[model samples]
Target: MIGNMEIFLIILAALILFGPDRLPKIARELGRAIREFRNSLEEDLAG
Candidate 1:
């Protein structure tokens, strides 16, 4: 499990890099992109 300090650092870095307004949207898009990539890999493996 990730420690609280590590999580806090990650959040801080994200805030610094993305700012408050864009962070949530970027996170959501990144999550979606990762999910889609995983799904595509699974489909390829299945076929």
Candidate 2:
């Protein structure tokens, strides 16, 4: 719960800093990066 609150705060800060126009593009790129990182980590663990 506390961690979620912190994440929410950070997201709010990012939105303020980046503005509405850039935030969606930033989020999409961030999501893709996270997905790629998780996939690579899983592959490493399997190997």
TM-scores of the candidates are 0.80, 0.78
> All models: lDDT?
0.98, 0.95
Candidate 2 stretches with Cα past 4 Å from truth are 1-4
Candidate 2: clashing residue pairs, number: 0
Q: Tell me the deviation in Å of residue 22 in model 1.
A: 0.5
Tell me the tens digit of each residue's lDDT in model 2 across 1-47: 57988999998999899998999999999999999999999999999
Query: Which window of ten consecutive residues has the lowest lDDT sum in model 2?
Result: 1-10
Per residue, candidate 1 scores C-alpha lDDT tens digits across 17-41 of: 9999999999999999999999999
Q: Pick the candidate with the highest TM-score.
A: 1
Clashing residue pairs for model 1 = none
Off-target runs (Cα >4 Å) in candidate 1 are 1-3
Clashing pairs in 2: none
